[model samples]
Target: MSRLPHRASRRQFLKLGLGAGAVLGLAAAGPDILAFASDVSDFIRGPAVPDVAPTQLSEHVWMIWSKDGFPTPENQGMMSNITFVVSEKGVVMLDPGGSVQIGEMALRMIRTVTDKPVVAIFNSHYHGDHWLGNHAFEDAYGKELPIYAHPLSKREIEGVQGSMWHSMMERWTNQATAGTRIVAPNRTVEHGAELDFGDVTLRVHHYGPAHTPGDIAIQVVEDELTHVGDVAMDRRIANMDDGTYVGTFRFYDELEKNASSRIWVPGHGHPSDQVLAWNRELFEGIYGNCLKAVEDGSTMEEAREMVLADPRVAGKAADTAGFESNIGKYVSIAYLEAEREAF
Candidate 1:
């Protein structure tokens, strides 16, 4: 008897006693069957990540900072910062990294600082990179552990964004994030809700659509620190596809007024009081120029040129991550928003 190939083709079924109709039926169901099989095959846990150690940002807040600004196969999906607040009660986490491996790494780092279990989690937004690590925390702390998010964020995550982010992260990291599951926030948090965790108090602020329709900024009141998530990133151009230039400005104004935080922690970079200021200047340069171009009835290409020439954008171009590659697209988004505002 001849040996069959490792992966037998659909047309090779005749040799296995399958009739032509059976072969056709198999062909019809092949995609779904293969998908299920692939999912089962990929069900194993992702490779373990090395401990990156945590950096203390304040008396109560420490972060496992990812050196890389974006996910890659080499980094294994460790692109977002995992911030945890150690309190007398327990730990409160904000944006638990990006993958199961990263989350496990965060857990290892958290253990280094304190032995307390994670008492709560706050997902900054519906972005998968910021919250997919919820899998590790939930697995460590149990299913009943409350994961919080804005109502809109929770709805979108549980609806479609959860699976969408899981798939995107896998593709982006070349399967480094394989086996990560979609663990949406089980509870909802709204603006102005203050959560007390023993000596540490966290204030939640959501000031309209900025990065997304529901971006949550969590403030550690005692430490004067606020994790702004992707609403305002440091050194990197925030993705404006699901965001608005006008709304982001409004968010900044509202956040500064409401939170009174001195140090702003970002999802992708080092925490500093200047994080929001740096982002604000860059955004103002981009959006301010676009607004001017719209008022002058300039073309999108012309608007892009204006934004590129702005002093705020030009100065940061060399140091900002993905600036050259992403600026054109973001400028276009700003242009459209400017046009809308003009009309």
Candidate 2:
């Protein structure tokens, strides 16, 4: 709730996006007037980002988020986040950005770290914010690099229309092209699997139906690194649009410790380990809010209102709606995984 002052008005932002001069001038104006710019900068580190961001998180890992148009991307293209780790096998990347352009930038950046081929590409989930840029990166690095995901991811990629695929790239990253067509997963596992990057071992944990049916959590086998795709979100509302609320509770419980990780990489936001316990608490709280609504015989819409009205949910209402828009969708999805029937 404690946020920095906002810099530009919406109208001012729109105008500044038209060119660079206005944006630069606006950034120089005053502290309050620069809040929005600072917020956007904190959102990602690339292109127009401030000079303060440290491009490297460590000798082998990176924290990355890609957005274009921040420009036209607000309405189209993609806003993506990625994590890169260099292992003796090669550089293994988790989740490509929203578009090929963004993905390409990520790839190039990875090259900056090491010339090793991108041996493994992990699609954190089916979402574009996480995986749409697969094509560009795959073509450059070779699709045979072996895509990894939950079984459903491969099915979604190969299915006709692959409806989610097209819409996500087009709307989120604004990149809708044949090259963006996704390739199904080559490796699929349930529960958890460990990937050995020669010198480094990575543990990928799959929790059923949270965020997406294929939601998985990755942790550096022995180091202090963990990637909790969308299961553990930041101040930015978690994207439950895919129907993971009920399962998210179970998923949250699985991550009971963070002793193994010194740095936590969320699907978005800066990496930190402090979120382990906090994320667990947040999920429990969200699940409780939704369960109470279900107990009250509230309709999905009413359930949303009830959840939003709770002090726990009130502050996050705006972010919560990002996932609650299709209340019925979430309930149906969560119901499938709920321990007890809510309806």
Candidate 3:
């Protein structure tokens, strides 16, 4: 991989760039300084950070997935999958990881495949885990890269929602997210928009509010590959804290109409048709059970228990860790949405 020009050494990073004032401020913060320093060093050097290698899904498309675990220093907040497409013009990245370090790792992986500069980044939604890595691109290239997201996503990342997410990320990573900053997408993409990157063209589609209000799936026209963000988690029950259950099922129905023989890359987990089918079934079952529970006057807890006990959910939830909790949360959200719709 080609290294960035004028890469600073550790001493130079502290003495020349960061200086004594920043160092003293960090030192005064106590143990947090250690995590902060580690983050800084990773950002500066971008050395061989250990992460999953890119998987070639098609001739022009490659995907790098983070392990299905909570963010930690070891993973550098790589809790989402990143897909990049190589075109004659430059590289187009989709959903670039969670933090600055993770974004750096994604850049390193992209370089391993092609030396083309990243010309554009498309964030799938408003989730911090997907786009906070925008900072890394700016850090590496010494300029702001063009980032695109749905209009609602742009609003969310620029409002209180983005601030709350940033605070949560800092706490979750224990300050390993020190250099990560919220660089919201500068441009807003609408449904049915086509982005041409010379050789490769991406058709952006947002059926409705499924994963998040601004969830946009990017389909590489030549490859027949769709990067469907958290709208479709391959094998696990995706968190619904920011999404609606009914909208997810609708998105799945829309996907099925065109998903035949197409390669689908999820926001997390590996790509597979069977995984997509499983998620559709899971969403359908959750929606049905939530509606039933509401009609039966069941409490949110009751609805959660009932949904978890269902064969379709229980069987799939057992395959992945942390899904039981995710499903539990989803049931609660679903029940609330169902109640609101009933009125």
Which pairs, if any, clash in model 3? none
lDDT scores of the candidates, listed in order: 0.86, 0.59, 0.77
| Overall local distance difference test of candidate 3 | 0.77
Worst 10 residues of 1 by lDDT: 18-27
Worst 10 residues of 3 by lDDT: 15-24
Query: Candidate 3 on 169-203: residue-level lDDT in tens?
Result: 75575455655667888888998899888888898
Off by over 4 Å in 2: 1-54, 67-76, 160-163, 171-179, 257-260, 276-283, 298-302, 317-340
Q: Highest lDDT: which candidate?
A: 1
Ranking of models by TM-score: 1, 3, 2
Runs of candidate 3 with Cα error greater than 4 angstroms are: 1-48, 142-144, 258-261
Model 1, global lDDT: 0.86
Top candidate by TM-score: 1
How much does each candidate deviate from the true structure in C-alpha RMSD?
6.2, 12.8, 6.7
Q: Write the per-residue lDDT of candidate 1 for residues 120-143, one digit (tens) a residue.
A: 999999989999999888889899
Q: Which residue pairs in candidate 2 collide?
A: 7-33, 7-36, 69-72, 77-172, 77-173, 77-174, 78-172, 78-173, 224-262
